[model samples]
Target: MTPRIHGGTDALGPARWDFSSNANACGPCPLALQAVQQADATRYPDPSYTRLRAALADLHGVEAARVLPAASASEAIQRLTAWRARAGDRRVWTPPHAYGDYAHAASAWGLERVAGPALAQLVWLCDPGSPLGQGESGAAVQAALEGDARTGVLDCAYAPLRLRGASALDPAQRDCVWQLWSPNKALGLTGVRAAYAIAPRGSEAAVAALQALAPSWPIGAHGQALLLAWAQPAVQDWVAASRTTLAAWAQDLRALLARHGWACAPSDTAFGCARPPRPLDATALRARGVKLRDATSFGLQGWWRLSAQQPPALAALDEALQEQEREAVR
Candidate 1:
């Protein structure tokens, strides 16, 4: 298995000022948290996920048959790659800089990574993408949708957390591909491992095949409760309101990094990549309770991916940077 590198809690426990993960800083949404905590752990959710599928389908305004739930976004990636490989798909295309899970899944299924979307049997796209938080190019989406034979999966993981700009794929275009959504991050409950995908229009057989390959009860009761709560208007409202706060924090974060001499990259979501004025002592920073996501895994070396934090966390980061500078001078 390809080694997995991710953000959030580590061996030392969660960071005091964690800019490493893109989860909504204002979340663990109260409403969602209540639902999860009250979940009926004694009973099993419908193995077929009838009600859950319908809820997700209704949320997206799609048919119930189109909804396919998974353990998480990474789980969905692996399952899709396996399905494509089983159908003799030999090539996969992913954004130049994207979630490592895409490439790892392709490698596991023995699918060759192609240079362009048109040359591949499977294509992956992310909007308000991770690390950089940029939207996928329109041309890439078009290429993925050009052929009926090709399978396209658009990662909508960061869509709810988007702080600026609109999606590259509009409603009609999104219906043309698999829309993979993991709402945990937006709900501020990333600990809940649940995700679902909306299959492209008229891809029932493909959906069924992937579903058959899945193990029983891909999501547990707590996950089911979380997904159910995600469809609630109150929860949606909370998420929307949080975005306003997050946007302001993102702006403040950019300014903070700029003041410290770091060059930040533009991002539509709350998280973005930035280059420190000088090499950072990451271990030292961690020891001081600060953690940042290195962008090297996303193929961007010398840049760190950071998410907007609350003022207190931001202040802590400022202190950490100043300390680093003082140490360098000494």
Candidate 2:
């Protein structure tokens, strides 16, 4: 079994200067947060999620029947993988560097990892992809959608957080593939585990299969509240404004790392991968309450994926690095 490698809070709890997660630094959106807090936890959410589905569909301008709720993006990956596997899918293709769950779920469901999209039954695509914070190539996107029988899942987790570059798949093309969305990261409320997918226009049978596999009331009250708030105009405005702040901070992060001789790669989003002048002492940084995501798990060994943080957190990172340098000299 492949171990799941992730960012954000862990066994030791969250780091004070946590650049490990790509969540919106300017969030949690006040409206969204208020909604989540006010959720009616005492009672169960509507089992059918009729209103939630309608609201999300309205936001994306899709039919309610095409909206499939998920417990989280990871859960959706597993469920989708299982759906493909049960349908006799034997081969899967994922981005060279992507969220670990894509491969992890594939492995769990006995799907073989293929080298290319042309040879796979299920294909995973992420725009402003994780770790690298890069978009998929046009060729890859076209290939993933080529086969009528193939299952293509486009992870839109980072779409809302994208500071630059448009998605590889346009609106029309998106309707041909499953578009998975997890708004928690965009709202700066990563603690909420709720996501949904816009099923391909003609995937009624596939959506039914995925839904049947899901447990009743997959999304709890708090998650329902988050999703409802996500569709609001005010919440969308907050997310849009956050991008400006994140873009400036991203520049500060790049300059800070560059000054220390670290080579930073350009990313379309607020986070990017960078290789330090020397090997990083992750434990030392942790002790200083500074945490960064190791890119090794994402296949970029020797590099770290750091998200743009506020000024104070960035300063904490700088001080921690300088302290490490001083200790190395001693």
Candidate 3:
């Protein structure tokens, strides 16, 4: 199978200005950072993850039984897909532009992609979606919720980092679908791998099924620490404050790209897609200590996903793009 592509730090090492991964530009939150730093790696975490599960459950106002832990959001996707496949689900549906892992996991489990949610046995939804960073349509979400699909998971990875707009799903609707959260992004601790899911109301059987498929000790010491920090009131407060900074940075980045004749797509979150006046040489950019996510992997050819960053990073990008333009004109 072909390797899946992702953003953030990559094989080329970190970039000077990385508009690739959509982690909160204003994070890693100090509180969460301190928690991870202090996590003791000498012992195994509680195998049952009782305390961690309870903390996540309390954060979502759900019962502990409804909270399912995973090594990361990507692992959650794969495990959930594997469980659904084992349960006889043979088809999946996904948004037009979504995180690639959804399709990758589905394909790994022999699930074929169908054009619509109504026709698939499993469906994936990303609110304030990846690449585009836009909210999914209400009609589509309703269709997925009310459809005959055996399972539906809404990736809320970017929800806490949303710079504008409310979730498309109401509380009632939200209760009907699985909600997956990866706090590493919100805490600006993407290096830490940890995520959890709130199974839909009355999904005890499904949760149990997924648990059976998961390996023992899905989360590690540091992962546990990061998640516990994520549930704290002070950490959440920091996340909320970070959004204001991100909103301003996103605006500045968008304006900067627009000035360079890039077509910026509308987004409700801290990142979005933009198409430059000319094709970008990703390798060349990387060599210049700048990197951008090629949107082709997210199903958008000739477009790029740009994550909001501080002014210094944005300025570096500006210089890089200018240099590229100068060379192209030569």
Candidate 4:
């Protein structure tokens, strides 16, 4: 039998195509690259983050007082958890198959944690929830907060595909008012650790009080300057171009997989989860150079999450799937 030519499927070795994380496969903003390169390495990055905070504040539709920058989005969310889980309330809530760091951050606070639907104090949603890549509507998000309102954290870490409303989670439903946004997801600055979390308007004291618990500077002067440059209109176009290319390719790749025996779905963002038509596990397929993330990690076991952001990935995926089909039939 001929090898299937699924788009972006890694039929290579471990991390064959890095379908696990959602970092951009396209490229980083040249302006960001230049900024990092031109950074004064000897000088200490201003932890004050005056410029960074201001930039993020404008995007968030809040005062610079309402915004604070931490080392990573993890730092932001974790510190927020530490603040809320103070006293006797030591618990953080997350959806089943959420990011491990969310739980890790909560645990650092010595707080109790739970996953899957709940009315708990701390609730974490991917905005567009993950493994499925579907975003929850803003109203529904508000409802979740109002249901309890203790400390809500919107993990829009994946929302760059379509972006979110500036004030989508305003007024703090559970009196919860923290939103996590990682610039690395859309900007491909993964190693830079460029990430942030926004608190409500009156959360200034909470932010200041929680500062000691927060992590130090993440991206440094290099990352800081780069992020600002990326915020420009020209760089924004680069992001848009990448999105359009990936979106069209994703649709085509999904269609290609369906045409064969593989069952899959097109992702709303760059990631999509689907099962192979054959009786093969994601791990077993790895031996064939098709290492994909086991959906089990995302609470979607028996399936795999594949990234189709590059030109060569689709052909690789198709080839891998075809091979799998032949082996299964035999």
In terms of lDDT, model 3 sits at 0.89
Poorest 10 consecutive residues by lDDT, candidate 2: 143-152
The top-ranked prediction according to lDDT is 2
Model 2 regions lying over 4 Å from their true place: none
Candidate 4 residue lDDT tens string, 74-107: 6666667667777456656676655566667666
Candidate ranking (TM-score, best to worst): 2, 1, 3, 4
Answer with 3 or 4, whichever has the higher TM-score: 3
| Candidate 1 Cα errors over 4 Å, as ranges | none
lDDT of 1 by residue, 96-123 (tens): 9899999999989899999999999999
The whole-model lDDT of each prediction reads 0.93, 0.94, 0.89, 0.64
Ordered by lDDT, highest first, the candidates read 2, 1, 3, 4
Question: Compared to the true structure, candidate 1 yields what TM-score?
Answer: 0.98
Q: For candidate 2, give the lDDT of residue 92.
A: 95
Clashes of each: 1, 0, 0, 25
Q: How many residue pairs clash in model 4?
A: 25
Question: How would you encode candidate 3's per-residue C-alpha lDDT over 1-330 as one tens digit per residue?
Answer: 435999988987888788898888888899999999999999999998999999999999999999999999999999988888888899899998898899899878888999988787787888878989899888668777885455778999999988778898988888999999999998988999999999999989888888888899899999999999999999999999999999899999999999999999999988999999998888988988888899998779999999999988998999989998999999
